[model samples]
Target: MLNAIEMILICLVAQAALTDLALRKIPNVLILSGLLLALILHLLSGQPGAPLSQWLAGGCAGFFLFLPLYLLRGMAAGDVKLMAMVGAFVGPWQAVQIAALSAQLGGAMALWMWWRYSSKVSVGIPYGVAIALGTVGVVAWRHH
Candidate 1:
């Protein structure tokens, strides 16, 4: 059974993926809500370590991880924000794992799209799906 944090992360990423697929944009409102929820959950978790710092660091790690790609025009801002939202839930270490896994999945998706569409592949891929899958996979693996 998934905990509250896991459930919320899943719901957040699922919504992000859906919106990204349909609109090619992940709303800032969603991201902001997820971040706020993560902060509240972390505060209530009552872990020994500094929960606030962990949350901030995790968010920064996730954001910086993809900032370069965004700056390079390789990805959209929504994708970066989505990752940061995931990070806020899981923390920096898991966020890194999710980013790596998401990159692999995104690459596979890109390859498939390239092969299938050939010269007609102009639309941006909905990378939030990869991020969502990666986040869910890591959370499941950690809990299992």
Candidate 2:
């Protein structure tokens, strides 16, 4: 069940990356799919439909966790939605870890891109790529 969740997460992230790369936006379908997949995974894992408290906490956590960045326009709406969906799946702590890992990898990629492109780091980073990669990383680490 977790494996399926992981696969869906990775695929959704990849879809986000691809769409963002090609059109500078992530499709609504991709985000919805991810959210739905997480909900299904949670239920399938024999957990309650994510207790209201958990959902509320996770949603708030995920939103606040990335709110400042988004407000600063450092990330897009899709990225934020994706994180919230992930929070629904794994709760606050794991959401934080995933965000951290994604940020770390995304930072590296941005730095490299900056170095290669006039040493200027813009508010925009191709973060969906990092998310896609980090989802796989998180899933692997958690399973192990």
Candidate 3:
């Protein structure tokens, strides 16, 4: 019983994850499109508690939450932007939860990669995968 927003979120994250895995980069066009779609959907839905302010706040929350990692060079700009796009779809609170879950998943992936590579890992992990999985988990859980 996924709504249009949920469906679109799934598609956006799936595409982002695949692109990041294949090219090690998430494209700006993808993020922009998601953001634009989110805005339109939110405006059209007229759902309570989903005002334009919430949308902007959610995007800001997601961006700021990941900004430190980007500044430290621990992650790419694409990851940050992807998170912001996700927040635009969800909201500030769910975005926070997704960020936490994504961080945990990304850390686990990093550890596994380090161990599997004998601590000589050269390439960055596709963190968009973690973000995608986390977002889906949170959204599904909320629906449940």
Q: Write the per-residue lDDT of candidate 1 for residues 49-140, one digit (tens) a residue.
A: 64666688889889999899999999999999999988888889989999999999999989988999996859788999999999989988
Q: In model 1, which residue pairs have backbone atoms overlapping below 3 Å? A: none
lDDT (10s digit) by residue, model 3, range 51-97: 56667888999999999999999999999999999999888999999
Runs with alpha carbons beyond 4 Å of true place in candidate 2: 49-56, 119-123
Query: What overall lDDT, based on C-alpha atoms, would model 3 receive against the true structure?
Result: 0.93
TM per candidate comes to 0.95, 0.82, 0.95
Q: How do the candidates rank by lDDT, highest first? A: 3, 1, 2
Model 1 residue 30 lDDT score: 99
Superior candidate under lDDT, 2 versus 3:
3
Give me the displacement of residue 33 in model 2, in angstroms: 2.5
Query: Which lDDT tens digits does candidate 2 get at residues 1-144?
Result: 366666766777778888777786777787777666666666667666564544446655666777788898888887787677666656787778888898899899888877787655444676777766776788779877
lDDT of 3 at 58: 88
